[model samples]
Target: MANSSTNSTPGSSAREDAIRFYQIAAQRQPTPAETAAYKFIDPLAGFANCELKIFEKNSDLGGTWFENRYPGCACDIPIHNYQFTWAPYPHFPSFYTGAQDIYKYLKEVAEQHNLRKYIRLSHKIIGAKWIEERQKWQVQIVQTDGRELVVSDGETKDGEQGEPFIEECDIFINSSGAYNNWRWPTIPNREAYRGNMMHSASWPDVDYVTGRTVTLIGNGSSGIQILPAILDQADKIYVMLRSKTWVTPALANRFAGENGANKIYTDDEKENWSKDPEGYYAYRKEIENELNARFRLYLKDSQAQQMGKEATKKQMTARLSAKPELVNDLIPDFPVGCRRPTPGSGFLEALCSPKVEIIWGEIDTFNETGLKTASGKQVDSDTIICATGFNMGFVPRFSIVGLNGCDLREVWTQELPTAYLSVTVDKMPNYFVMMGPQSPLGHGSITGSIEMLTKYIRKLVSKLQTEAYASLVPREAATKAWLAHALKWMEKTVWVENCASSFKNGSSGRTVVSLHPGSRLHFFDLLEQPRYEDYEWTSLSSDPLSMFAWLADGFTAAESSAAADLSYYLVDAPHLKQRSRCAEEPTRATATGN
Candidate 1:
């Protein structure tokens, strides 16, 4: 592994710094024996293949791990089941692992596969443009110190010098996980509150909840986790529910101890769970089968038949009413599974605490000290945490300028962002998005989805080298046809028609980022093999001039100059500066300016 002490050269462009980082990461010189392990496929028959570049936004990683540092913030997926089959966890433990364990497992994977050398930490992709002439992508990246660099030719460039620092790659992988970008609610008095307020993604480092009256906004997974922890510290804790949340009692949440629930199979339990082959193989197959079965049921909406579709709310209320007052505030008005169902932990125990309270009314506005609910009730609190999740409707912050200089966000403004199986885009060539639109798995482990996408990209890279193809993109017709099928499948699933989920059309007025309503197995089958016919392949030799034309036509010198001019005007304008600050900072006022 390369040493982490290397910093970007002073006065280097953001692109230059990116190139430096990429080079350092790409420095894993493969041995001849290792090179022989790669399978040469049809398209990439004779081309030289060496490295793979995965451009991930470090900010998203921070939000995923950093913001969600709640006490019980562990993964719901079983540890053994949450890993890639090819790269299984060596010390796979029983039961679902906590957040720290998941982070450790991810770090171990990066280290084990020598993936650490391929990651450019603290670097954010600012812009990516397709270079038609070179049949490559010109990716713009920003370093932590605010330097702008362009990476291509596998080298980094300092923007100030206007020299080529890095050569762009044959393929790009985006592994930005879901929920990195926050989606705040648009309720009354969202910004006017004077108390300390924070989003689940922006939880503070201090123990401010101790001896204080705390109000937690949102009742999602994070909300459920926080309720129990804060109840121990806060003098009075009120869990505010904007909409109803689905609840399922998982063994991990129900049983608490060093042993917890036995997710790992014992010799005796394994025999019973499988009743097939003896020993470890039986255990593995049993667990995988059980998870797959649940995934199938989730796709089929079996829960609706067992408990009734609308009956989820009433059933949940009754379940919690066994403890009284807890059900009054915890029960949501919306249908269950309208939002994702979180495993109900010691939230019932916390509500039973005399110091805790549940407020069901909507917020009217924020006063000088506390929140004023629409029911004319005043709830006083010192610290307020907004568990309000991310803005799912928004596309990633990365700027993607595609055909005719079209922006990706603009194209996906109204509809939920659609991609060819949540991987390729129509206008974007040689660019692959990891965990993109409609790729999230409602059941089963997300690591499975990540592994599938990574494998597909690996295969595509091999194809590019074999065919000696310069670039490959999904054909427009194929993209549309696939989306039609995906939508049709989604219509049958519960999230599409029954749920009032943020994953649906609740916040953005459109559902832009959710998977097809189907079993994870079905999704896995779709991505198990590469469908080459679904894409359009362009060779650098046959369309050499066209590649150059695309590059030349992308951003002209005049356009670059215009962008710079606009940047100057926007930066210097005093009024715009104030507006920018307000836009960037989350306010404690009402949702709307009522």
Candidate 2:
């Protein structure tokens, strides 16, 4: 959790009003993952006897939701199923959630769980090195006062920075997601352009380009979203594309009104939800089942994939039918699920607007005025927005030196970043990562994925505490075996067989580095319990004769402490009482003194 202040972008009156309306609508309910994290942490801390600290780089709780407040920014998944399993909201304003609503929901969770105290805002970890002797990670970090840290500055901290310090921990879990590192296109003279340039990740106030021409690059989620938001306001918009990307509609309605674009909650609906939590839970379950059923589309030649491809094409064609020229320009050559499917609500319609021009070609270079295409088309613009996508380097962006000076960046540079069950790396002992290599968001909501990862992390912590282990690192063979296993399954998935997309190493690459080979269900079961045998463990105690050293003072904690219940693990006291009575009864042999 970080600072809760929202950045108010003041420019066009219409845009400002839209933002204000979103703030009000999204303020009503807590997001699922927000509630989930709170519910899990409270129980986990007590059960495992662990201290939790949440380090946030931004001045906020919602990760992408906090940063990407661009126009038409919303989740494509059903809002009900896009959260934690235990925290369902009946009073959601839409089927999908917008960024503002997401941020508010997360804030609600932090406040409700009293998680702010444990959270260190503006504290960024610069590097972490494993100390073999101490069996801990020596983490180097820098702290700021909730100001955005510059990435390209070549220094860890920004202006007027504090001294660099170190924090030691037994286990280090990297939860900074893939979207945090933004990827810039390698266009010639990119910085030399004498115009306003911005990436969708750090979208500043567009007050200067209210009625000016703007050239937006890339066709990923950000590009699709930004186009629709600025269409009516901008004088002219040029959308550059290297390759066509599949665009589909949101799976469900997120708003309340008949329009279903921007609906608010009625007082009655809100009251009903507050009073009927169980009913709302059932509703959330139904949505979850619907989402889970769609996982079949990932299969290489499944009927679901075929139907999905056809449906997406049909929908996109109809959306751009008004301007038939864009139908072919936008339709992707690859399969629908090959890459992340962009669920654009008004994107196709926006493209049909008179002011929006769709330019199809690879951007060769960026001159002082604007960029020129591969086909020698020079498109002039007063502003350029790079929605080129992310670096997708699942490896830690900062320095992480492991055993024998094995830098994580160097290892990833040589080969594909590999992890054991997408949680633990082989050499990186006591280090766990969330949303690491092979953890895909293709199957379901990322919130669900996060909770699943958290459960795995909790189990790892419990094992470390209970076993009294100094260090536990996965066997090098185990990590290789897991990757090989994932590859076998990847061979059958559409992500590998279909035409290249971001799911692959590159748009035209063969290796699928992002997606998990198995379904979300499989991942949940696989991570539920770690294979202890697969890891080479180090015991804290060195004495060979003291095998049961953990059994301190020759007594269980319950037996030693009068306040503790010895039979706490026993289930059903009545059954135990019946067994005790039977035992107390005198047998014939015992009576005869045999």
Candidate 3:
């Protein structure tokens, strides 16, 4: 019942601001005379309604948490830190809850908020093109029952019957996350394997992995967690590693169990959290402060980072003592935070088991039964489980064509996929993104920051809705300046160290492409207000004088409203304005999502 308040500073709450301007478009159309009245100004005059649509590829919600059901699939970030800042849940069973639990929690959220009405599950956006004449995006989408998609201008890649239909929108928001589309390892004769093969993302039942000899690839986040999870069940496991990586405890490990493993909550603890709002808020703030402060660990050669590395090494070395040689093969030479850190609970212990074997070097080829190593060593297994991760090279699952026939995919492919504040591109007008390249996800919690970014997006959309503006896109010079500044700041961080990372082009590249250079709080501050000066816009009215079209009538709708408070600005007002609620019908929308 508690934990509803967010942004309890001096003035209005961020949550209240978000609720007030929730996706509404201009209500009134201003006449030519009103628009041309340049001297007259109005902050809010013609603002009304807007429609929001969500296209989900899967049958259910929960993007990664629903898809990745691997043996030890759980959030590396604790549940408290991962939850929405505005809508914190009092009852999370564990600090690192499983995928199922996470999915169920999301499902409950959708139902409670009536979000499914705006969402079209089993729907996927195939392509998007900016129509200059209309100042809108013509988007193509299709309903799929989880079939293979082939988006093309001519024909389907498989010649399937699923033809995409088109829908036009004033704005297009892409939430197609980096890890949505997966790719197999580029091992020669990968398809020739007759043995059972499965990806960590597209995992089947745990029964399928039981009693089978498994050959695992990639020791990243997924690989790290899967080892100990299936160690006791599988007959034998051969972990294939291309390079070494550090396995460190999770952020805010003091709030978690030993070595930052999952900490289960007791019934009494849940009851206390549900009742004591201040106590729960204090606890949550303490955890978040720790999470934000740990950004210092990424500062190259800093005292905090050095101490962190040594502490992590001590923990990892002790755990790998049973097989001391793993210290050389498993630990990385580069500093911590070079690669994404995950607390691989019992992973080092699993390596000590006789049934588990660690193989060095990449898979040169895959045989009919298993893998053929670069040294011509034949590694046999009953099943090959490739945890070799997603195609996170910034390639889109669907095509996106921006202004002047500029293909966004080509731009990203040819040059670095940069953005304006990691939100929108140069030519992609009327476009916004949730989690894009160089986002605040490095030191920040992924899902938690998404909520913040959505508020920023909401603020931008409100301008287009209330103000009589056709569209606005980031300026080319502004984007370039932002990118250059980001790159410069990144050099001071540990991410620039020589390490094999998905963030870079490959093992040797020093450029960090995936994370924001600044801290989470810095990103939040940067996005607290929209910078309209750095953008190029076209007014809704094409007339040259219509540039001031937002000043129509020099009046605000609030002045006419019966429930509005005229003296709202006065400090310590005796009474606050109270507005009547909408009827049940319009308050709850059941329109079919396009």
Model 2: per-residue Cα lDDT over 1-594, one tens digit each: 111111212121111111111100000012322432453357544333344555666555676677776776777777667765654556667666687886676666677668676566666667789999887888777665666533422143553258768877777777666664677788888977899988878778656458899998978877888888888778999988777778864553322234334345667876787899887777666667666677887787789888888888888888788899788777877677777876776788898998988888788999999989989999889889888777675656778898888898789878888888887888888887777788855777877777777677666655556545667888999999988888887877778754546565446666776778788887888777778898888766565444334433333444545797777767776698778877998878888999
Better of 1 and 3 by lDDT: 3
Candidate 1 at residue 419, lDDT? 85
Weakest ten-residue segment in model 2 by summed lDDT:
19-28
Position 356, candidate 1: lDDT: 69
Error of 3 at 576 (Å): 16
For candidate 3, what is the lDDT? 0.71
User: Which candidate, 1 or 2, has the higher TM-score?
Assistant: 2
Clashes (backbone N, CA, C under 3 Å), per candidate, total 59, 3, 5
lDDT of 1 at 552: 24
Clashing pairs in 2: 94-254, 95-253, 95-254
The CA root-mean-square deviation of candidate 1, after full C-alpha superposition on the true structure, stands at 20.6
Q: After superposition, how far is residue 172 of candidate 3 from its true place, in Å?
A: 0.3
TM-score of 1: 0.72
Q: Which candidate number maximizes lDDT?
A: 3
Model 2 superposed RMSD (Cα): 11.8
